[model samples]
Target: MSSAHELTQEQSDRYWQDGFLFPLSVFSEDEAAEFRAELEQVEKDWLAADLPLPLNTYKRVNAHLVIPLAARIAQDKRILDTVEGVLGPDIMIWSAEFFIKEPQTKQTVGMHQDLTYWGMGETPDQVTAWIALSPATVQSGCMDFVRGSHKNPILPHTDTYSETNLLSRGQEVAVDVSEDDKTHIELKPGQMSLHHGLTIHGSGPNASNDRRIGLAIRYLSPGAQQLVADRDYAMLARGSDAHSNFVPVQAPDALFSPEALALYEQVRLDQSKALAEGADSAVPLYTKM
Candidate 1:
């Protein structure tokens, strides 16, 4: 892997200590704009066709499976290099989702640890790379992290299944988080942040005039496995995966190709089985807007 964009020792230490690091320049402004345009164009075309599932459904889970642009971004060397600094040479992309908060929307992601419902146990090998395609500021609902919270064991969570919550289960940490404990991470377009899977974090509603668009790509090492599910899929973004804990997948050649769409459907259904486990509500995840 290229060392050009790898995280420095101090940066890695900060991440391990604080559970999150932000404002890493991963893409140029022009490049980020191009990616945003591609995403918006896909949204425009798909929405016009009036697909049975909502547009947000496609954006919320494994978007890289069907969107070539998303796949390319997920496998970008700059991203992989930085990821490798913490996860070692071998890294697998577990999932990628576009978390979009439209202007003046009530959509909020309550304070929660991601691993609470992922069924992945308390593994330290997993990290989430959140790339900002738009300005992520306080008004744009930028994520807030509780420093060193990843050190805690997986905490209790209550599923809200709220219409305005963006989480798969609308889950939140059972404990109240004080505002003073939070570190609001703001990023400009083309910048990114990395947070541990066990990190306690959340974002409020987008009150800005423009949308807050972020592409969150989950990465895991070769040793990671899905204990609760029969099978799981991932794309090897870095070195070889000797463990083969996850089924291997290739990047799509075209956006929403017939083959890609079929694969995405199968992945969506199978993955939801794990994500929705033990949920109180029967409402399927990534199925509604």
Candidate 2:
């Protein structure tokens, strides 16, 4: 019998067919509130400190490396079980980022495929588990996905790098996306969504009164490899990583530990190099936030 956390066969089938699944329950509302509290506390503490980089830079990239709370959530069994149902037993976390849109913020993510800039090729072994710490509604600018877009090869993307765009390169699919083509993915606090790496997806600005907070953890199969960079970092979330495709990442024992910060910087710089390759404009991922 499958575990309670595993997705049902029907659900798994739907995910494969649609290239995405949504509003999967993982944390309870109370538990999600606790997580949000912890994240906000980290923000508050960082704002008061003399950190070399802006807090938003860490939030956009791999906050899990420096934040114990994010690391814990990234390795949560409930989330992993669901991912395992799709990607199988062996799983590696490519990255974890906190995508937070403040109320009334105009920063938007242009519709784009996740694997387009990763240099991971057209492989379908990657999945992104986006867990919401706050309500993600249409009014709040929840993600909108193009159904069955994952099956298509990586499409050409334009690097707009617009200041109002949330993406580092403002990469948008070269094809046009009409209103009828989008499926709005709305979620309550504590719920999550899983999408294929090639799935064409993006979200609008948060117009709601509250901030829209979502932790997007990218999971990869052990067989997947990064082609652009000589080195890649990942944390083995479950099963055995027989392929040894990426450098092992250790979970932080304490928030913002010295060791963790160093690791974060190393991973960030290396990943940035891969992402910015062949780009027409400056990549904003590692820049001052």
Candidate 3:
């Protein structure tokens, strides 16, 4: 629970230049353990379902119930201070998604920038922080980024799901990079990596006999406008002057303190409202058609 004021200038430069930077041990073991337990509970709930696509599965993948834990981590002074140092104090949590690679599930997240999904105007201030909840290694499908790829123009690629069961889709298009220029990010639990939204990066498959779970949170500067068409999920700020385009899913009261559990309830309500209103109308930047 350290303050978020420790982001150094070197780290900022590294992120800006390379499009990604890894900070080791950002979350303490206790915090990681708490999240692990919460995820286990979520998994249990998912396993009890008989549907082809369990409701919890989709929710977990889309970062529904995980808001409580993510909010806790995002609000930690240490992380928040760093975010402020980089993006500023007026900020909004853009989007959160879980990349879970189960044992023997060979899925490679194709190389692409996160901004492509949001269809927003480009800005260097937008970044996505992927927090490793489990050990991420080459054998367990760690993420790999193209060195200096963020400096290049955005390239087009076929957008599809990461896997077709247990192997990659086996489709590759030529990009202006070599194998020698790629950097594999091997992270242990509690470690995290920050990357520019336009960074060209992808992950390997889980060849090992374990699951690889990572939580990704996207943050935007306070003034960054929401270019995405749908606005149902967008919550208008009621009290704060934070004119952010990204909506706050976790309740303000539960953002910190004794009644944190109540935040999840609010998130559930918000999610339900978004669903009833059909909020996934954001235009995709790329399509395979």
Candidate 4:
């Protein structure tokens, strides 16, 4: 196998020091837009069927389970190779989520590090690949990160669960960060970025005329343990699961088939409960309405 997917020494070093690297071309602009069009129709059907996106946030968790393209994309060589350069070859896809910022929406996520309540064990060795299915510009609520904050202690977060907030718990970092030091992650369609699990990042509302859609896929090393007692699942993408830290999951046979949807629902509910562990407000897995 070729090592072309691996990151350069400079790219690797930048990630270690800054907690993020961005705007790397993974797909052509045309290819990404086509992918977006295909998934957009799926979302419409999902919405019409009353099983729309996740409820408490602007997320569609584990799209790979019900969306075939997403599954294939999860295994995209460019993404995996680059990730392996940082996380090692034993990779496990913990989850794939769609974070959609609708045009002229009031939804906004607060500055907070993930892994806060991920229940994904102590080591924040997890990396999230945020791929732009649409243009992820500053005007369209692109992600913003606090430089070098990934190495800091786990900051306190308060669950607001506000209606307009895009986070599941509407969680926000309970500390002040210097705005002057913030790094904006802007990507054209087909481009992607990677960020450490502890990176303090968030985005604003979509004020542009067009929507901003991104696939925030979480990739982890097999060494990381799942902390949720009743729920543990992961799909190995490369190498052996030597530690057996997570319950192995297989790929779905068909999109939205009875079997596939059933499995997807169960896991998502389990995840939502885990996320709502210490949440102050109601955090249902998806919208009840």
lDDT of 1 by residue, 64-94 (tens): 8877888899999999989988899999988
- Sort by TM-score, best first: what order? 2, 1, 4, 3
C-alpha local distance difference test of each model: 0.88, 0.89, 0.59, 0.80
TM-scores for candidates 1 onward, in order = 0.96, 0.97, 0.75, 0.92
- Best model number under lDDT: 2
Lowest summed lDDT window (length 10), candidate 3: 280-289
272 Cα displacement, candidate 1 (Å): 2.2
| Candidate 4, 37-151: lDDT as tens digits | 9887776666546444442122366777777777778888888998987898888888888888899998888899888878774475689999999988889999999879888
All candidates: CA RMSD (Å): 1.7, 1.4, 6.4, 2.3
Native-to-model Cα distance after best TM-score fit, residue 156 in candidate 3, in Å = 1.3
Give the per-residue lDDT digits (tens) of candidate 2, residues 60-154: 88877887887899999999999997999998888889999999989889999989889799887889999999999999999999999998998
Error of 4 at 195 (Å): 0.4
Model 1, position 140, has a per-residue lDDT of: 91
TM-score of 2: 0.97
List, residue by residue over 76-106, the lDDT tens digit for candidate 3: 5555566655676555565556678887875
TM-score, candidate 3, is 0.75
- Colliding pairs, model 1: none
